[model samples]
Target: MNEHQRRLLTAAGLTELRFDAPMSECCTLRAGGTAAALIDVQSIEELRRLLALLTDEEIKFLVIGRGSNLLVTDSGYSGAIIRLKGECNALAVQERGPDFALVKAGAGCALGKLVSWCGGQGLAGLEFLAGIPGSVGGAVRMNAGAWGQETGALLFAIELVDKDGRIRQISVDALRLSYRNLALADGELGSSILTAAWFRLTADEPEQIRSRCAAYLERRKGKQPAGAASAGSFFKNPPGDFAGRLIEAAGLKGASCGAAMISPVHGNFLVNTGDATAADILALAEQVQAEVFARFGIRLEPEVKIIRDESCQ
Candidate 1:
């Protein structure tokens, strides 16, 4: 590590930080190389302090949640990796009115667990998020949605730490959420961190809510490939058309590029059948996009975020 990074690490009281931490162990895809350094921040205060130190040193860092929608390169990241898995998992029903309640969840709270909690409490709006595997912060950033409902729909407001380490509140409208995208600007990219989100949900019959959530979970089980290493749907559905349908039509199902294969069960999903590398996944994805474009004249865009080393061509 550089002198500046070494000094900053010592100053933050995190001298025991992991060097070359395995990226595969932290990600859902179970692939990729290691981070140059992995610092686990377990509290808001620690996170704030760490960010301050990193910013002062001008270190490039990334805030990772559950690592569900990520693809790190085989060569690994050269900068520090900040993770908030255990620390930012607080979730609670903060307030309740006559007909609705305000539920507050930390950014790192599991999206599925939050939905399950809401469903158990007879909350109606979060049933659609029951099976989506991601952290609440990542969900909000991705505007994650399934079965026609999105995270932004229930988000009343979000608490974030700005670049200057100042805590700020941004409302749902300010997010400018679209399909699989949020309003995280370039300046606020890694500098700002999502802390918590307030969700507004209506009171409903518990049995009905449970039934709906169960149905959603069942549907997800039927559609998505389970018990496999994957990053969920690889491509966002093209406007007025489905990416899976296009890929399937192009005869890309079960197509393999090294260890990565377009899932035979779901065309939009690329699964690592053990021993897949980031390069393999990228090649498979590119081939799918190319074949789909050649067949239907529609270009498929990746929903998964690819983080590669600068040295990677």
Candidate 2:
């Protein structure tokens, strides 16, 4: 962002800003170049103000959750990065009926935190998110799921700000989700920011909810690699077929390029052994896709969001 724009942001009550923020620090992949600016957005009001400013000035910006599913390239991002904070991270019961409760969760709330909160409140249906590592907003935007439960399926409504800085609370009918993809029916995925989500979860015994959550976490841990730097899964599962199965069947279970490797424990996971650059991971993923396609005549699509250098893109 330019100096005058920075001054405008400050005057707009959105002051936590850093110029040339390193994306490596922002992403879970632990490797990236830099963002032109990084702003810690503190509230819904602050978010609206910033969005208005960016829209008016024609500045590009991206609202990031926990950055778990993101892979930013070494050449860097050309826009500013906005991280939600304050009211954007709050969670509460919006309404309660006899059989179900509507829960409001800020987009910035950690998925794990929401899961734990659900378990504590005896809310059923979100146990599948036990081990997911992104923010609620990210999860909803990406349609994150496990064990046949997708986040989009449970959400009744979503709050977001459009590209023009208009805040909206759209119905789930406006959300189009399939496999691991989520897009608003309005087609605002590129510029709109998901601010919060409301989920309709049925009531259950707290102990039961917790038990189910634990089981899901256990299954995830037993199957996926633990304590290694990696996105949860690399490829989307094809119809009636698992990506991990194809990857392993193609003999890429323990493949490596530089520090990046397809996990031996789970063929779907691409890991950074220590110093894997973003390019290393992308190259490795591409190799997986090519080999799998060559062997099975099926091309694998990445579930991880690869952030390319805008210059090259």
Candidate 3:
């Protein structure tokens, strides 16, 4: 099935397909095994065609962007990995007024780059996402937030492809966006592939917007570990209490399992100390969950998407 899909994709004009592609190069964690195949898609037409081929051949696939929040297992993925490239990296202002503007961005645009673009253009409201990692698609799907503002608050609409290959323009309300999650009309989590998104932002002085971005970046620098391999915060804050505070309160800061450790700089962060394996990280996370649950009665939920399956090996 996978071979048939690959041949079809190649015949359809994709030449950047790789077999046993290194996952470490793709994810932020910097530690993961190879995948079965990785396909670099250049345009929407190519994606549509490739997805059709995969669907017809019954080959399992996952779409990825920047791979910031992904944690791949050491055993590797046994399915196709589709990555957006080229034309999907666009960011442009669709409509502009004295006090507001509608910025339309491609799904593969880096969240940080989008924020920076807005700052440079004197657009405000996305300053909170200044240093946040991942692409616009991933941000929208996860409702990625920082400070007090979330991605959903600024999202006006999204163009996404449904399971049946139907392209739909959905309003923010239709997505039912919530804290770190998006839901469908059926009350289930959404799995649509986002192609682009429109965000509403207020017009501000570029200097003012840059100042706010600087402040946010500085705050992140002070609180989060820099120059290390990590998937941002390991766990989401549970309700009113922060996961960092809980893990710190449980005395797990700087705790280690092999080379993976709870960062001393931030208890909510799990860092890969050069040689940490996915298993090591998972073990440390489990230990942190157990200790925090026992002490504070709050079971920490991982924010990082741990990609693993029976076929990982």
RMSD of each: 2.1, 1.7, 1.6
Give lDDT: candidate 2, residue 287. 98
Candidate 1 per-residue C-alpha lDDT over 1-313 given as tens digits, one digit per residue, 9 for 90 to 100: 5766866686678523787898998788888988878887777787888778777877778777788899998989877887775557888888998889999898988887888788788877988888777899889888899988888888899999865678888877666778997774333344578888999999999899889988988998858888889989999999998999898889989999888999999999999999999889999999998888888899899999899768433
- Candidate 1's C-alpha runs over 4 A off are 1-4, 184-190, 311-313
lDDT of 3 by residue, 146-212 (tens): 9988998998998887555778888877778778886765565444678899999999999999999
**22, model 2: CA deviation in Å?**
1.7
Error of 1 at 37 (Å): 1.5
> Which residue pairs in candidate 2 have backbone atoms (N, alpha carbon, C) closer than 3 angstroms, thus clashing?
none
Error of 1 at 120 (Å): 2.8
Model 2 scores worst on lDDT over the 10 consecutive residues at 6-15
Q: Against the unseen true structure, what C-alpha lDDT does each candidate score? A: 0.84, 0.87, 0.85
Evaluate residue 139 in candidate 3 and report its C-alpha lDDT on the 0 to 100 scale.
89
Candidate 2, after superposition: displacement of residue 166 in Å?
0.7
What's the TM for model 3?
0.95
